[model samples]
Target: MSRRAAASILVLTVVVATAIGACSTAPLDVGSSDTSPTSVPLPDGPRTARLPSADPIPVSPTPTPQLPVTVTTADNRRVTITDVSRIVALDRYGTYGTAVFALGLGRNLVGRDIATKFPAAASIPVVTTGGTDANAEAIIALRPTVVLTDASLPSANVLTGQLTAAGIPVVTGSAGRTVAGTDAQLRAVATALGIPAAGDALVARTDSQIAAARAMVPRDADRPRIAFVYARGTGLLILGGPGSGADSLIDTVGGQDAGTAAGLTDAFTSLTSEGLIKSRPDVLLMMTDGLASVGGVDGLEKIPGVSETPAGRDRRIIDMDDGELLSFGARTGDVAVALARTLFGRP
Candidate 1:
């Protein structure tokens, strides 16, 4: 992930989550429409939710895009899409790409963003440059029939404006993303593409997977405090506080959000020695690439006051793929289960 992508993780989630209130107790309404996920197979006590490494997206309910549909962009522009045969979805976390694939339209995607790390999009042409920033020239060169993008990218508004002027229709989803809006994000893409039924099916499947994973947490076990640290080197290190997507992940895994508990109100804040000590986290969670940027676990300990905390003293740091950690789409359930299994441990 680029440094820009890492920073947007904070920007995206907080924008839409401000009115939703507390991050820890906020619940995603999966609705009361279906039975429990017994058919999905619960774990055998110690472990659950085993997933294959490649993370294949199940394109069930075979999507048949019914274009010529009129949709409203996040910017309030009314866009009518006539052709989805050549589609381009872009965002900071690859969530937009995941949404398209989730709707069974991956084969239609002609271009991808830099943040797409999932195995399925491995061969797609990358249009974004250095970070998740849109390369206007590259994207325009593709001549996509329609472009699906969000404002999370640093230059998305300008890029979209340029694309609009070029006579290419652009359908913008929400300006940012959040764990609670996962289904909404997916639905927005599907709606724009005129495939609400397929979107509903995918949402149900994703919701079930997440529900099953959350059920694995031991009700009686003491919840561990987890701190999400975003590092891009010595000069730029931030913490995921309240309203940050990390709080939702921490809540999902039955853990306390250490940054919020430490009284940090802003979504992302510069990491300070005093703040680290005050959080008193049992484990420090980080993006995999972010950790590497600071020179790995050994180098992470060298930070001003990291070694003094319970997490640092014991070297209890858990890192996940940068693209996957905060994307909060398609693979969110698997991401939650992965973290839960590690933190909760074996029976």
Candidate 2:
């Protein structure tokens, strides 16, 4: 397929179309694999492997397809989705917001986080700061038809109650939380919005990109040691442990997580500069703004013992967008590709 054709499909159906600047060429060579649902044969109790019949059995043509209907959420209230025209996605999780955009729902979004920077989401209004913490008043003021949020969203029940009282539907999921789970969440959300087919296609595209990147990294080599550093105020780094999004991303890209070395938990643990130096990670991954705010590479090297660490010696520190790198949602596939490239140097 040609790039023009692919772009048209994305624009018409993929929701958040990636801006590739319009130089006409072949469509993304992600290469299609068969995804058509296969027919399953019935049990051998019935006649099996019968020869093609000359006379076909008469059957009903079909039943009228059901139109989009209201799905009552877990809170026990009915909210209809006949047609999703206007959406106010107060998604604090970057990937959830990005997934909405990717599903071609960007035009429907009325609110977003300050950290959201997807070109498709640029015109959408910012309503809240990005993170697990959400602003209910700011979100409600937007008057959205539907709201998409993460599973770990702080005050999730409170926000859902508020939205329900206001008659707005809320959809929450763990999709932007891990690679596999995130994929499943996307499918569920799309299906709920009456677009299961579209959701499947979007996942196919992203999954292909991730698979391509993963294929480049050899499974046999020792995993590269990676550390995630989040600046928490002054002189504090919130390090991610097992079960956190950071750990999932590192493992996906065949990198060993620094937190795992210390047997950390899913919650962020404070790490001293001395501890980081002791970890001596091969790659130091951090959110871009946070890394720059504390004086960039030079400042990082100045930390006690950091100057002697392998990461500092080789200057392997990599800064990434906070939302995309950390949000574990639709953009995670893209994140995986970026990390893979950084680790493998573009084979």
Candidate 3:
């Protein structure tokens, strides 16, 4: 599809949008493949997926960006950036902000989104609010020279409009929630910042790390059935389907996607007990915060369809930090490694 059309879609849906900027176009072509859920045996021991520690993902040595960079943004606009004094990378997953840090330009960030929760950026002023939209006045106060963001935010248009009105250069792009898409995301951010070499270096490091993590999964082991669930109290209970990004992680960790296997066609669906039971997920994957919102493990089993499934019966739940688990950025390899260890390793 044309970039113009894609941009329109990007402005609408954060997760299902397939829009991308000119900086890195090819990587978005890789699509998520669905796997049918099967009644496979699990490791039977560990019931949760936890990282060894909460340390932020490591970064590569910083690189200098050759300035006066011109980029054809995802919204089909050519924006030339000459200053990098104050930058704010905003998005739903903090992918762009993380990329800037990986490129060694973290020091230039003037403001950050809620999802950019790394220690290095802990002190940066937050510009996003209400979990989904950004605060225009807060960003205006920072007077950022350029803002790197994408269609991941539901109010991306309004946010961009307000920023543009204030004369801040906003280059829109997408960090698709897929393993391959992460490569393009890093490259796209570097392109926007006039740091192609750094992007390449970061991508290389990410690739090697991901390969090592992938190697940890035993080829002969049985494929586990994983269902990605989004829970927010008793009000919102969504299931991950095709293009949800969870399916990619599930497959990467050597598991089949239960929602996809159960014929969920959309990226997200209002979860129903019958639908979940039909999928028969061996493991229920959730965001740490999302799990807690519903009152933790005990609360999750009490959900309508949860108690009838194998995952609920066995208390098989694997949760990661909401901000990091689906960020789909530089730390994907590390995330994969931790998940693999939990699903298959010894206590």
Candidate 4:
């Protein structure tokens, strides 16, 4: 079978499994290779709880400056960075610029993409508007010496082409959404900025914090059945399955991913009312802005399958900032801890 055909078959298999599990009385076993529902300890608690406000992670000391380096991008393009005075970093989730700032290079960043929030990035000039679509004129006017971004930008090639023609180096990083993917992103940004040591330091700190947070999750506690729904008015998507940042976050927070158990393999897929109702998720995860767009809990309960599901009946929903929840940067550990606290009521 062709790769595309195999992928289609895999997705179909998962979807079928999900439909079965959703209708069954058992909990979905997402950690298993086969699509099946397995019984696990179900923690006794109210279906819904208010999420606590999260504090930002403290910034580390600035690293000694390093410059005059050449780095290869994910696209196999080699770009040399001779000056780190004025850097511009862009990505759909703002992970690229956040990573740069985490490496103690915030002072050098002259411009950022629209999604680049947190730390000192909020004060920087935003060069993109419409979800990673760069304004070439606005970026060029900043006089950036180096542009570090990910492939998530819709007009990435065009913007990079324009910047390169203007004699600025453009390096594109990976847009991976896994834990290791975040590490690779940080390394790529650090390499482009000629600060490998700083990158290592930031990664180490992030990894350590994540480990500490993971340790706090109770091993004997019941793993909640969680489903992440991306909602923008009438447009709704279910994010789960293997190889997604959502999956990793769920695992870290000791939750079973309903989408993965249903046999879905993609990062996100259209949510069906039947699939959602059958999945029987105990908790629904959503982006704060997305939940607001749908008119909050009352509005969410009005959605087709949502009203019939256990989550909807119990009003069990957790909402996080769209950018921070998946950015997987310096605050990843904190995010995980916060989610765990909300789900299991553990610090």
Report model 1's TM-score to 2 decimal places: 0.82
* Ten-residue region with minimum lDDT total, candidate 4: 13-22
> What lDDT does the true structure give each of the candidates?
0.73, 0.57, 0.73, 0.67
Candidates ranked by TM-score, best first? 3, 1, 4, 2
lDDT of candidate 2 at residue 151, scale 0 to 100:
40
Residue range 64-124, candidate 3, lDDT tens digits: 7688899988888788888888998888776777777767888898898778876788899
Residue 326 of candidate 3: its Cα lDDT? 78
lDDT of 2 by residue, 215-307 (tens): 656543556677876763347556656655678788877677887776664446666766676666777777766676668777776766556
How much is the lDDT of residue 106 in candidate 3?
82
Q: lDDT winner between 2 and 4, please give it.
A: 4
Clashes of each: 0, 8, 1, 4
Q: Can you write out model 4's per-residue Cα lDDT over 186-216, one digit (the tens) per residue?
A: 6677777777887777677667656655665
- For candidate 1, write residues 2-80 as lDDT tens digits: 4344466432221110011111222335774543322111122111223345443754647777768998889999999
Per-model TM-score, in order, reads 0.82, 0.74, 0.83, 0.80
Residue 229 Cα positional deviation in candidate 4, in Å, after optimal superposition: 0.5
Pairs that collide, model 3: 273-305
